[model samples]
Target: MQLLGPAQENLTPRGMKARGALAVMGTSVNMQIGRPRLQDLLFSERDQEQGAASIRQLLREIRIALGPHRDAVVTGPGWVGLDGQIVALDMAGRAGADGRRPEFAADLDIADPEFEDWLRDARSHYEDQADDQLAAGIADDGTPALILQAPMSGDLQAAVTAAMILQEAASRVGDVLPLHVVHGDPGIGKISLGIELGALANRSGNDIVILFAARLRSDGRLLWSRRFVLPAEDSAAHLRRVAGGVTVAILHGVEALREVVTDPRLRRMPLQDVFSYSAVRLRRADEQLAQIDPNGDRAVILALRSYIRHTMLLERLAKNPQEEEEMASDMAARARELSPGNPTALGVNAMVAAWKGQSETAFDMARHAIAIDDENPIARLAYSSALTGMGHHREAEAEASAAHMSALSELGPAAWVLRRAIAATRIGDLRSAERYFATTHGYAPENRPALRFLSAIRYELGDEQGAQAALQKLKKLEPDFTLELMASDAYPVDSLRRAGLLKITRSGLI
Candidate 1:
C-alpha cells in the first residue's frame, strides 16, 4: 500500500519524534541477491556491526553540534553497562533499550559519496560528510544525541545503510552523468523504505532534490515520487546532478540503474550489474540468503516471490496487486516458467480464474493442480476454493475437510474448517452444518463461529429455546450480530428478511 502523503518538504521539527528508519526488504524467489528479504540481512551479525560502526562515526561529528550539553544528552548520564557502555534501560524503559527510543529520531547522510565533490547547478558542491547529523538523537540536556537504532522489524537499519552505500557506489562511477538504479525485490517494501530514507535524508535539510523522469502528481508526490532517465554513458553524471543539487539523490526503482548499464553508447557504463573494487563485486551481486525454515510455507513463498519481484523491479515491469486473487495465478505461472516440476506450479490458471469470478476455470485449475499432486497444500486449498465457487457443495466440504486433515498443526486448521462450514450452510444441509460445527468445536473450543452457527442450525430445526441460547452465546461471541455477516454474499437478497429459508422479525437481514 502507498504511504499517506508526499515527502514532507523539511524533516519538520515535528517529524523528529518518530520510530523513523527505512526498511530494506525484497524476496529471494530466484535468490539473485541471495537473501529472501533485505530484513533478513539486517538480522545478520555482519550488518549489525557495520551499522554500528557507521552510526558511531556519524554520531561523533554530531556531538560537536551539542557542544557543552554533551553530558546532559542521556536521561541519566551516570549509568553504565555491564562493561560501562551505560545502559539506557537502566532507568527501566525511561531512557532506552539497545535502540528503542521513547521519543522520535532523525538521520542524515551524503546519499552518494563519489558525487560528494561534484558541483551542483550553482558553485556549491555537496560535501561527503553528512549535513543534518544534528537532529539524529536529541539530548536530555536540550541537545541532540546521535541515536543509532538496532535492526528491528522490517530490517530498517539495512535500508538506510543500503541507500548510503548505493549513493557512495554511484559516485565511484566518475562519469558525472545521468543514470542510477534502485533495484530490489517485490513486496519486500522496497518502494516505501526507499521513500522513507530519501525523505528522511531530505528532511534533514540536505540540499538534494530527487529528479523525477516525469512530473509527479499530488498523490505521487506524497509517495516521494520522482522520475528520470539516465544517459547511456552518463549514469554517474545524472546521480551527481541529483546529488550535487541536493545532499542526496533519491532513486526510486531498479530501472533507474538499468538505463545506465544497458546503454549502448557509454564505454564505462557497467556492461553488467557489477562493479569490481578489491574484493568487492558491486554489480549483479548475488544477494546473501538467510537460512530457510522448513516449517514456514509463507516464508518459502516469500523466498520465491522475492526473486520474481526483483526481476520486475529491475526490469521496470508493471504490476497490479488488486486484480483480485492474481497473486496465486502469477505465482503458478512463474513457477511453471521458472521451475515447472516444483508441484506448486500446476493449478495457477484455475486459481486466477476463480479469483476473477470464473468458477468453472477455478474448478478446472483446482482439479488439474490436484491431479498433478494431490498432497500439495496450496493446490488443495486452491481446489477447495474452486469447488466452493462452483457450488459443488458436497465435494467442496469433503475436499476442505481433507485439507484440514492433511494439514499440520503448525498450520492452524480453523480457516479450512470455516470454509467447509460455509459450504454446508450454503447447501442448506442442517445436519451437515451441525456435524461441521461439532468437529470445529472439539478441535477449536474457542472458535466463536462453532457456537453461533450451531445456534442457527438449532433454530432451523425448530428448537426455539436452543436457538435462543445459541443466539445469546452468539451475542457474547459477537455483541453486534447481523444475519448478513453470518452468511455468504450469494444470498438472494440483501438481508435475511428476503430469504425464504429463515425468518427474522427484527435487525438487519442477510
Candidate 2:
C-alpha cells in the first residue's frame, strides 16, 4: 500500500473513470508476469487479449535486460513483482541475495498514464475490500479509536457552530430541550455538521458514537439503546451495565431525527443542541437583514433559503400530516414568490405537491425543474422522489441514476442510491436493488431503512440466510420493530409504495 501511495494520490476525480493498462518488459521467453484483478481487463473483451500479450512481452524484455539476475525476478501483484506474485515488501530491511527483491524499495514515478490509472484503481479496490471486512464485524482490541470522523470535509462555520451548541447544551439546568433539532434544507450538510460535532466531542474526551438514523425500524428509545450496546445480545441491559460517561450520540437520518425529537427518553440524555446550516434559520435571519438593507446582496440567498425551508416543512408534513393545515396555509404562494426561476425550488415544490397528493402539479413542476437545470443533483433527487410517489418506478430509477453519478457530495450520492434502490425494488429489478442497496450500505451501514431494504432484497433473491443475517443486525439496532411500527414509521403512506413494502415484509424474515 505504501509503495502505491503516490499513484493513488495522483488520481483526479475525472481520471477515476479511465481504464488502466501496463506496457513494459516484453522480450524474455524465460520470465513470467502477474496482474491484479482489474475492472477494465475483467469487462473489456479486446483489452483482455491485448493486456495479456503486453504483459508477456514486457516480462521477456525484463528477463533479457537483467542478464543472469533474470532467474531472481519473481512476479507479484501491485507495481513490483516478487515470489511469482505482486507483493508489498518491508523496504526497511536489507535486500535479499536474489536481486528480484529490492533491499530498499524506492518509489517509482509511473510515467505511463495507463499504469498510473491501474495503480489508482487497484488501490481503491483493495481499500474497499478492507472496509467490507471491518464492516463484517471484526473483533476489536481493548483500545478502540474514539474519534468519529466524517467522510467528506466539513464547513468551518458548521463545525464551530455545532461545537458551540453542544457545549451550550451541556450547561442546561431543568426542563431542558430533549433533542436539539438540527432542521435544514435537504442536502444542506446538517448530518455532516453533526459528524463534525461528534469528532469535536471525541477530541474533548467524550465517548462519541455517530449513527445514521435510516438504519433502524424501531422507536427512538430502542434505536438509541441499541447503538449504545451494539455487539451485545441484550441492548438495554448493556446500557445499564455501563454506568457513567460523557457519551454523545450524533445521529444522522431524517426518520431517526424525527424519532429522537419525539422520544420521551431524550430529556435524560446529554444531547448537543445544534442547528447548523438550517434553511429555516437562514430565512428568519434574512427577513431581519432585509430591514437593515432591503437591496442587500443576500436577497437571492434569502429567497432560496425560504423556498428550501418551505419545501422541508412539506416533507415533514408528508410523513406526519399533523402540521399540514398549519404549514400549507400560505406556504404555496410564498414558495412560488421566493424563487420562481430556481430549478431547485421548482424540484422541491414538486416534492411538496406530491406529498400533498397533487399529482398533476407535482409532475409538471418536476419536469420543469429538470428542463431548467438537469445537472442540479439535489433537484434531480427531489424529482425522482416525486416520481416514486406518483408510481413511476422506471422513470424514478433513471432520474436517480443520473443524480447518483452527478452528485459531488457523500450525502447526495447516498440519497440517490437509496432512491434508485427503492425504485428498482418496486419494478421487481432485484439485482439493481441489491447493487444500489450495497452502495447505500457502504455510505451508511447503520441506516435502518437501508438495512430493511437490503433484508427484503436478500429474501427475494433466495438468500434466506443473508436476509436473516440482515434482520439479526436490524434486531440488534432496533429491537422494538413490529408490523404496526414498521407500517407507521418504516414504509411511506403512498398506496403503491405501501403495497410493495407489504409484499417484501411478508416474503422476508421480518
Candidate 3:
C-alpha cells in the first residue's frame, strides 16, 4: 500500500512487480485471493505456466522486502494470502502526518491492461474512503472561497489587472453562481486558480505575453489549464477577450468542484454512482439524495434527480412511462424554481419536456438555456434532442455538432454523438449515421442504444458479420433483446424501418 517514498527509485522491475502483487493481495477481502485471480491481475498476458512462475518469483521478491517478516506470506495449492497475525495493512499510514492523501501505489506501473484497470478502481476506492474520513473535519463556511494566486513571473501590474478582469467576468456569467474569488494561498478543501505570464518577442521586436492559467483541486490534482498569447501593447482589449475565454473554462472547473464541496454525501460516492444508467444504481443514488435534501432546496440535487428519471425513461427501466415522466417533470420544475437562471437546470428541464412530448415547452426552455450561455454543452444537447423529436433533422444535426465541440466530459460526447447519429439516420444519410454511431460506441461501449443502432445500420450496409457481432453484444447486455423487439414500438421503430432491418427480419432474410 505504501509503495511511494524516497526509496522508490531504488526498486527494480521485479521489486515493482512484487509491490503490485502485494497491492492486489492487500486490497482483497481478508488479504486472501485465489491463485488464478492473482495470476490474471499481475501476468494476464502470460500463459498458465509462465503466469504461475511469475507469481512464484513475485512472492520471493515480496519476502525479501518483508525482511524478518518473510513468513507473513502464506501460499496454498490454489490460493495466496497474507497472514493476518503477522501482517497488518495500515492504509491510513500511507497519508502524510498532515493528513494529505497521496495516490495509492503511485510508483507501481504495471504494463498490463487488467492490472491498470484494477489499479484505477483501487485508487478511486481509497479516495472515497479518505473523503468519508475527512468530510466531518471540513469547516462550515458561509461561502466556499476559490483562491487566485498571482503569477510566479511577469508584469506584476498587468497580472493584477488580468485577475480582476477574470473575476468580474466570472461574476457576470451566472446570476446565482457560488464561487467567491480570494487572493491568497490555497487553504484545505479549497480550489486554487493560478496564472503565469511569459514574454515572447518577435523578430521585429514586437513583444507578446503568453498567459498560462491552471486550476488545481484541494489535493493539488489539476482540474483544467489553458494558454493564451496576447499582444503586450494596449493589453486592455486583449486582456478582456482573454478573460472572457478563461472565465468560461473556470466555470467548467467550478461546476465539477461545486458538487463535492456542497454535498457531503456526493463526496463519498464515486462519479459512476451518480451518472450510471443502471436502474438499481440510479435508484440507490435517488434514495441517498432524497435523504440529504428532502425538501429539494438544492437545485443541483433536484437536477440530478430529474436526470436520473429521464435516463430511466430513455432506458425503459420503468414499466410506467406516464408515472416516470410525471416524476421527471416534478423534479425539473423544482430545480428551475430553485435556480431560475441556471443553465443546467433549464437544460435538464428541456430534456424532460422533450421526452414528455411537449415540443413548445422543450424548445422554449432549451433556447432560454442557450441564450444564457451559448457554449453550454448540456443546453446544446437539449436543443438537439428537442429538434430531433420535432422532426427537424438538419437543425438537430447542427446543434448536435456544436454540443460535441463544446463538450468537456466523456459522457457529453457520447450523448451528443448519439443525437447526431439519429438526426443523420432521419435524413437518410446512412453512411454518416454509421460513422457517428461507431464514434459514440467508442466513447461509451456499454451504451445499449448505440449498439442497437450500429447493428441495424451495419445490416443495412450489407455488413452481415459486423451486424451480427453488434447484435451479439447487445444480447449480452440485454438478454431479452431480439429482432422482434427491434421491430416493436418499444425501440426506435422508424429508424429500424428506414434501415430495412424490420422488413428483412420479418421476411426471414436476416
Candidate maximizing TM-score: 3
lDDT of each: 0.37, 0.42, 0.65
- The lDDT-based order of candidates, best leading, equals 3, 2, 1
Candidate topping lDDT = 3
Taking all chains together, each candidate's TM-score versus the true structure is 0.31, 0.37, 0.57
TM-score of 3: 0.57
Better-scoring candidate (lDDT), 1 or 2: 2
Clashes of 2: 25
Which is superior by TM-score, 1 or 2?
2
Q: What are the RMSD figures for all models against the true structure?
A: 25.2, 25.0, 20.4
Q: Candidate 3 residues 107-213, lDDT tens each? A: 78889888999999988988887664434323232233455544433455455555555554455333223345554433232322222111211211343444444
Answer with 2 or 3, whichever has the higher lDDT. 3
Q: What's the TM for model 2?
A: 0.37
What local lDDT does model 3 show for residue 209? 47
Error of 3 at 93 (Å): 26
In candidate 1, what residue range of length 10 has the lowest lDDT sum? Answer: 17-26
RMSD of 2: 25.0
lDDT for model 1, please.
Answer: 0.37
Per-residue lDDT for 24 in model 1? 13
